[model samples]
Target: MTEPGQGQEPERAGSRAERLRNWWRPEGTWRRGIVLAVLAVLLGIVMLLHSRIPNDVGNLGSLLETFLPWFGLCLPLLLIAAVLRRSATALIALVLPVFAWVSLFAGQITDKAGAGGNLTVISHNVDADNPDPAGTSRDIVASGADVVALEELTSAALPKYRDGLAKAYPYHTVQGTVGLWSKHPMSDPQPVDIKLGWTRAMRAVVTYHGQPFAVYVAHLPSVRVKLDAGFTANQRDASAKALGETIAADPAKKVFLLGDLNGTMNDRSLAPVTSQMRSAQGAAGDGFGFSWPASFPMARIDHIMVKGVEPVKAWVLQPTGSDHRPVAASVKL
Candidate 1:
């Protein structure tokens, strides 16, 4: 005879196997989490066809694209819910979004930075209301950039930055609110009209290695999201269009655009500009080079884009007194 409980072991094991099978049956797994499955599929479709989303209504498409990367967060939440619901359908549906997200951004997540470049450039939207413009200038100097472009310079803070960066960057020009400071010589500085009735953009030719390249500095109109108005970016959008036309008409073989665009590269409204140039951060940075809200950068409103130049590396500099973080890049001139 067997031990008292030994005979019942086979029966218990059989019962466990039956229960597992029942949990996976169509009635148990497929019937549940249908909502979650649909949501996952919809997310996949949205990310894959983000460009097709119409922007005419409330600039909804542009708004969604601006923070597109953040949508990845939903995947994990969906996964947890699927597991709790014991839904095989939802688990399988998650693959669609996972694949879509990876296809769109996997390359960006990888380390693409390489070792060397001929010129180092930096850009910042030094807040107009910064408490310490002098200190912010010092922080920029420490970066050892060959070229520096600054935006949002207020009349009150101008003297401080000028006094602070004068020694290191002897060649500098201030046109309206935008400025460019360079170790090398700069000339033909003028304000660019972005149809704002005021100067918020400027351009200069900087001579590096005895060759000149056009450098544009612009501070596009700020955007806002109001309960009734939706994404208030009409001014910014119009400015971007005008700026693109100006850049296209430039005769320089090599060009560099630096400033606070108040929009992302993903934003379709910026296509006129982004289409013609390559983003240094997208090509060379290790990660998302977000440079806004110095305290907690969520997006890369500040940019260093190039035309007819090779980007070697890109990065975000440490925070300063300004509300925006500084962005830097190295490129082959």
Candidate 2:
């Protein structure tokens, strides 16, 4: 019933429509490439602004730092896809995250390789209920720390730590659950009120190698997790702010703080102290160096921070009988 030219024109139009649909449909490789590119761009921005922005998004910082290194895994996957799809643009996008990670940790690399100058320090959260006080003491003493600070000291466990650490640490002071065990004599030891019940944080002046330095040992309140509340980091943040004020008031220029902060250095909640102090591990550690819930460490909650000391080496010790691992660092005053 149709003319020959009219039928041929309809067929041509149908074919053109089919070709357009095929061109617009996204294939598997193309979809993956787009996703990788977007992720890389977002992660790059996060890295770029990490220092400027406070990491104190409740428990968000802790969560991110715990899983941050894992993000690097996506890099390899992206690279493979880029090669297979021949996506030069997508490949370039992957470089953003790599650069961001390097920028965030670049200072640490240089500090670790630098020469040591004069002090050795150790920091640990000796669990209040630890069963092996002697073993904990032995491990710490073996670290050769000129000054040792301990948090979570209990009345029952205090004597045990003292007796075990007596040979190496002659001068020491206990303020509530926090204490300082030093190889040199201590002067002006006093309790610091971090607004936690009783006294769980304290400060002391110790003369190591004839040089005077203000030392602080603190056990910030533990963070909690709940279904309703994702991460309860409020108490820790308040305590950090109070502690920061105390440190800022100190007369000594050279200061050291050691403890189980219950938060990572990357966490913005601890910005009060973190802003002023340099983390020993972040300055000189080899890897992620997590130290928490000793059964499986996903975050570095234990820290050794210095105000006027240079770190030579920093590392986490093997697990004792506590829920957290001890962090040790060799430094120069």
Candidate 3:
């Protein structure tokens, strides 16, 4: 072929690119299939680098990270679309998300079960409005956890909680709306000031197997994301900070914090606590084990964190008439 003029090369290349774009979204092929493929790859990138997103829009980074793993579900859908439409470009783009999804989450997909643990800890946010607090407490007690921390212990339900847990766990303490029950002896149960003008958090020392460690139970103030304002929980953020300070300053050789933090580990607002301690679920659980919205479990708000302890297993329990499911973890003390 004869060599094209310099200006003609640019025009020809532009025409070729236009033709390629048209082919990518040709009417003969499914237009949506092409778009879906690109979207799937974008989801992978977003999940992998969600931290880079600005949190100014209601802490958007966290909102995405909270459901990051779920984004992988779209990959298969895109692949199916590409196959049904027989679009080579779309099919090839599928590789991006397939690997991206695997790279970002493959490590978490495997199950690490059957490991023995010296201690079992569970945390739950018992909805304050729960009609049967006693039944709820009974269900948690039946889990056989060595230590149990419960949040949203309303005044009306406190008596029922005390009565229900007294038989299985003789050692228990309640501070504000948070409470802890232990099979072992516990002491020094004191309220942790989280600047909520109320006792929503507390710390206690428990002697397990003749070894003592500190445990903290907290119910951080609620956070709201409204149309006008984003993550409107100024109080919750402050409460988390105060709780983190308490955990950091703690003199105990070992520490365990369990409760409803009202935020996920991905949320930077709770970085104070997440930074200092390790999430039991993240360390050993089979899956995300979301604990909130008991009916569906879309996010994990109930948590078990530890310092100076190793997690051997972690899991989320079924709903027990509460708005949140119970989270349990086995630890090597």
Candidate 4:
């Protein structure tokens, strides 16, 4: 040996390296905590800057907004992991997403309890290929809507819906693929051209309880998002613009639009309609009230919008053997 403590120094240095490896190993809980915290940070960033996400690629921003509510699931899972591992770091990091999500969506939630409304109205897109038109019509009648607007009214199912609702409504009119039923007198049924060559929209004046109001029913052309073209459905956009123009031109002091617009209020593609009218759901619904893909609704594509009426309640109806759930709203004329 060269020196008395020289060999001992080498041994201590080797032990130090081993200890360092142990501290930085994959099995450490601290590493897991760090990962969770980083995820939380990423979520916070996404929530805060969602609008910046480019839509040119595939209308990715709108697609994200469509299912944005699901993002809230992250906080609970992170909190559970933190509790199980006693991870203070992850627990504290959860505050990021909590604040982020709250800031973005909290304002949308509100109380909806009310005494009642003067009129009940409903809208639906009973899928043209529905197998049981009778059952669907029965369910809608049971909903007790004073005025009902129906879209996607195919030749095969139109007669069934008319006969099924005749007794209850007494007054009805259908123009093109859309129709309207009311418990009061109806006048001047006209087709609204949505740039579709053929008609898929209509308007009428429904006189209920001595008050006549303009009602429009439409089935906007569908939109598609593909790998090559993004969410560019030129036809639907053109139709929406035309519909907006027609509504703007109408002379009625009170106007209501009911339809399967195929786009949510949040989608920029619907700016024309959303900008012109106030959504009954946005004003009075208890919750998001999504009404599509009847089995598992993820978006509120069906709508009841009003220009000069006051909505007192808004809600989504149960499935009626159709792909889209019916939407209902009560209002004061």
Candidate 5:
């Protein structure tokens, strides 16, 4: 009996030693990667309070908001690191960013496209130096849009577009660098002063099915990112303010604004416009609907915004010769 009890004591001591080893090992899930846990929390805070970030320095807040959707990529990267480090703390902290991102953008991932729309409109920034203006015009015709808006039109290429689109669109108007063409009759066409001293914006009343609505084509001043000046968007911001005022003053109840806004809906600088209008892509699009740098669209600078109209569906078209892809949207009214 004494010999059997001695063997049992040795076995119990061995089990206690194994438990101690596990507590101190690097593989312990709860005790490792405290720094990683802190970083995960910080990431979540930045995403959650993005709107509060100051834009006084480099328009940093607007810039981050422009690419806000891309921030989700960090979650998977941090998740891999947490797993490798065996950090239960970091893994739990990561839930904040995951929840914030999902809450902000999960609806965009699900298809919101529904059928039954009366009008289809297309907007494109045909590059000033496009190598194939005629081909681009042909592509626009193929899109089967009832109304088309083109920006950055050059004097040399304007005739080509006019000729290519003549039969399909007999009623058209051009003001400075932007133009609008519609199958329906257009009246009261005039250039809008966006403080640019040139015709980069225009408004016209288009009669559709005996009902009239105001259609605006604008190419807001472009923004540039400079190392010394940060986001040089003061000029664009001024133009946006002026354009928004003009749109607000219009007596028309239903309005459509199309062309290159040069800023996304998320950018606070464009709030003058975005505050009053609704983005077709955000309301009823299939996906992100990025439309710039045609080869690889990272942001959506071009827009189809509406007031007092219902967006049915929105989508991006196949690439044209221009640097920006065309955007098309259908509306109920």
Candidate 6:
């Protein structure tokens, strides 16, 4: 027969072992899953916030904004997993980020149906190495815009553009690589000198339907890619700031700014200009209307912005000879 003391020791050791095993075993696996789902939802919210941030220095901000929308997709997947696992708490937690993202983008969605206007303006990059400048010019003329702004006008190709555009646009001016063509009479045509050495931006006053309005055409510096730095967009951002200063000084209440900004309207770095002006596309465009590297346009780098004018319709034209597609819009004063 076993002694009483010996029997008690074995029973105690067995109890201790069972307690340790229970502790090591996964407790509330559903709870852990819920934590993961919540994390995913929070990540999505952060991405949505990041995308809305404007580009301050240039490409760096734009690069971040470009991928911001993808974040929203993550939340839905996480929600699905949470539902499948029956983690009701995790599923409910996702509501916070979902509502947050919606609140941020709700304005953009609602503002799309813009008020109507009576004037039309067009802006195009018309790449410097465009193979068919003539074709591109013809396309712009056909747009029936009261004012047309073109950027990246190389000296070798300016005459071709002029010859092709002269018939439709009677009054025109070229300041370095930037130019403005108007069906109406234009006055006070001059270079804006956005960049110190290169005059790739200009401004003019156009009398459209007998009303004089200030029009600015600009081509901000292009950004470059570097392995270490990602995108070197500082020059473009600086140019945008300078352009903003110029626009602020303009005495005209009604103004139109057109160009290849080398960034997007979503980019916060451009707040200097974006806050003061309004994008025609954002006001009336039906879709994203991407216009870069014309082969497969993914993002809108070209833009037409107006102040004290009404935007009625906006769209991107088919590619011609340039790497960027043209953007056109109709507006009224």
Candidate lDDT (C-alpha), each: 0.92, 0.80, 0.85, 0.86, 0.92, 0.80
Instruction: List ranges where model 3 is wrong by over 4 Å.
Output: 1-34
- Summed backbone clashes in each candidate are 0, 6, 0, 0, 0, 9
> Each model's TM-score?
0.93, 0.82, 0.87, 0.84, 0.92, 0.81
Give the candidate order by descending TM-score.
1, 5, 3, 4, 2, 6
Better of 2 and 3 by lDDT: 3
Error at 228, model 5, angstroms? 1.6
Candidate 1 residue runs with Cα over 4 Å from true position: 1-27
Over 96-215, each residue of candidate 5 has an lDDT whose tens digit, in order, gives 999989888888877788789999999999999899999999999998899999999999999999999999999999999999999999999999999988889999999999889999
What lDDT tens digits, residue by residue, belong to model 3 across residues 12-129?
Answer: 9998877667764556343546676677668767866778998777767766766677788887788787787776667777787778778867866777654779899999898988
Worst 10 residues of 2 by lDDT: 23-32
Deviation (Å) of 89 in candidate 4: 4.3
Name the lDDT value of residue 265 in candidate 1: 93
Model 1 residue 300 CA deviation (Å) reads 0.9
Candidate closer to the true structure by TM-score (higher is better), 2 or 4: 4
Segments of candidate 6 deviating more than 4 angstroms:
1-29, 32-39, 48-62, 73-90, 93-97, 106-116
Predicted candidate 1: what Cα RMSD to the true structure?
2.7
Residue lDDT tens for model 1, 203-289: 999999798999999999999987887788999999999999999999999999999999999999998799999999999997888
Q: Over the stretch 89-142, how does candidate 4's per-residue lDDT look in tens digits?
A: 677888988998888667557757355688999999999889999999999899
Model 3 clash pairs are none
lDDT (0-100) at residue 313 of candidate 1?
A: 95
